[model samples]
Target: METLRLQTFMVFMLSSCGFVLSFQINHLLYTQSNPTAPQTLDRNDASSILNSNFDSSLPVKFIIHGYRESGNSEWALKMKDELLVHAPMNVIVVDWQDGSSGWYFTCSANTAQVGEDTHLLISHLQTQTGLSLNNVHLIGFSLGAQVAGNTGKRNPSIARISGLDPAGPDFSGKGASDRLDPTDAQFVDVLHTDGEPLWQGGFGYYEPCGHVDFYPNGGTRQPGCGLVGEICHHMRAPAYYTESINSDCPFTAYPCTLGQESCSTCNGNCGFMGFHADKSQANEVFYVETNSESPYCRG
Candidate 1:
């Protein structure tokens, strides 16, 4: 029964991609100097990047939104604000809603181009301002997470790539070249909030695809999401991440297998799950518990 449902969903998603439409991507820049109003960045024009309020000395962070979302997405904006508040840095929101809203497959196919475009923009920044790619971090949600992976594939030196419940459809069972993988960045941290099978209405990838995969609440049907369903569980990835930016509470996670109840002895083997996740811990899986409402972290 589950297999039948999953096959049906896959057919629908694949067919949806057949109806193609052109899409244009935009990069919106926000710096401490200009928080609210974003300056449009043009990868082709060096002056647009170097002449603007962009600070080359600061670290560069890109927030890539998922399907049906724009650069002005509330979550993206909120994250940008929180990041800026936490520290002075360059936050670029990758807006590709024009291409994302058409179909799931279309949006999935477009992630490659988005990644290519982002890579070009980063190269331009490097050439123009001597920006260090090591200081670059890509934070993406759903399909946007795949976009980050594509970008990282083009430039493997990226410091970090955070996959916030990376979209599972069309990406599952694919090779490293096809979807987000551990090799995409120097340090890849994945947060899996919705890992149930597609037949079960899960929208997030179930398998661990990063160097450090953090599965909160067993990575499926997050607590307090009750009647809200999969979307709620999927969006929790970003909500938790955004709060981790400056929250006094810590999202501390303990090392454990996927369904392990407790760590026999963590012995300092634990790592902070969200913004403060330790990059040095490689190929580690951790479990975290969170509250149902805002201020989700339990410390």
Candidate 2:
């Protein structure tokens, strides 16, 4: 009888150890396999593909693309790569089913669809990543800027929204203007490239934020293009993403070359000669250059 009792106790101990090991293995796999780990969205079929190993404490950065652009744009990818220098935070590129076209120049139900889809994505982020209002930041370019602006205004979860050279033309006027202001967002900053595109309303028309208008490289056509009549669309990334706009601007003359120098003016005829949005705000506008200059209009 003593031998039998001892045998029973040994079996129980071995079984308990095995059970504990199995439970731990299962938990690890569950967290690893599921992308949106903590809170999985029932709607998206591929939400499980996201890495569940996200930092809960760090802020979440959302990058929204333009109308016809994808999350895989060269600039978007580069920014994501550079931003990784700051760890702990997770960067998610939002790709909505927006109709293909000029991208910067389009407005319809399809446009609204992009905004709606973005909100849904944000909601999903909140659930899975455990991000709160102050923990979210948005960066949008052109129409993407408008999309970010509208979404930030509507969604309280967003902390700050940065509009990189908002697309002009279609998004001008009074009623249309009210939707894209800095005040509408928790904190908004509008950077205009073709500030007052002649086709739209000329320079310095839209004023969403009474303060905080930032201009990079004179806020006009991008640098490097030599005497080109067209506006600088390619200049968006270099203008904002670079170390400073002043040095980069001269390089991107209208007829861009290896070494070119052009006077910085807004005549729209000179190479790299372009003027964009107004920096009339009281806040010291950051030309986004390494040099420290007052953020106001200069000749």
Candidate 3:
């Protein structure tokens, strides 16, 4: 029976989702501080996969990668490091580098199954570690953001989810069930750093979809990003989030009043964004500006 289950796991890992494509989907999963030594969990081995503790009392953070990137990417590792420095918690990175490569549309289409399969993987881990679902936080970047959204859909009891500039390509203008929306979890916060309309080289969703949607620097073109390469603008979302993890100054946001969606002004009470954010200020839009370099917090 054990051998049969292992064979089944292998078949699932090497098969494509549902786009008439069949290629090996290797998931280089990491549940440790070091990315160089990631354990492939699909082999049905859990006792030896992680050398750390998954305390049920503490929160679990899953940091996912974006297009053409893997768990070994700088952003993934940087965020993991920052989180560990801030708190002693469980951090896992989902590496779908094999499935997320190739054509853009193909990769976009693969997120649906990725979310489903990842949810199953997390569920399996929970059973082993006796972890609570309420203590899980999903922080997904770009396409991974959408995957996190779908994961929330798969398991609706998650405490909170942070969509770091969810990819706008196949998800924009989609319904709440189709893309990242407020109902996906108990609290959902989104950061928009590259919301330029799709017609204008935008890499992120332009609309406010989360409970608290933060638009830093007008949420269009970032301050230091070049005029031509929009990737830098999109990448700023995770950078700012990483800095917010351990910075002396937090990323505070100003509320936007009625009919003031695009206003660069601040009104009413303000709240901090990212890891230290308050969930009480949900269903609102926030705006803030940052410096051109490290310690981007203006305050």
Instruction: State which candidate has the highest lDDT.
Output: 1
Root-mean-square deviation of candidate 3 = 9.6
Cα error, candidate 2, residue 160 (Å): 0.6
**What range of 10 consecutive residues in model 3 has the weakest lDDT sum?**
9-18
Error of 1 at 165 (Å): 0.4
Model 2 regions lying over 4 Å from their true place: 1-51, 102-109, 176-178, 198-211, 227-234, 237-239, 242-299
- Tens digits of per-residue lDDT for model 1, 245-281: 8998889888889866545346678888888888877
Ranking by lDDT: 1, 3, 2
**Model 1 TM:** 0.93
Better of 2 and 3 by TM-score: 3
Q: What digit string (tens of lDDT, one per residue) describes model 2 on residues 36-109?
A: 32332232633542545445466666666654456566666555554455344656665542342322333322
Residue 217 Cα positional deviation in candidate 3, in Å, after optimal superposition: 0.8
Residue 255 displacement (Å), model 1? 0.4
In order, the Cα lDDT scores of the candidates are: 0.88, 0.45, 0.77
RMSD of each: 2.7, 21.7, 9.6
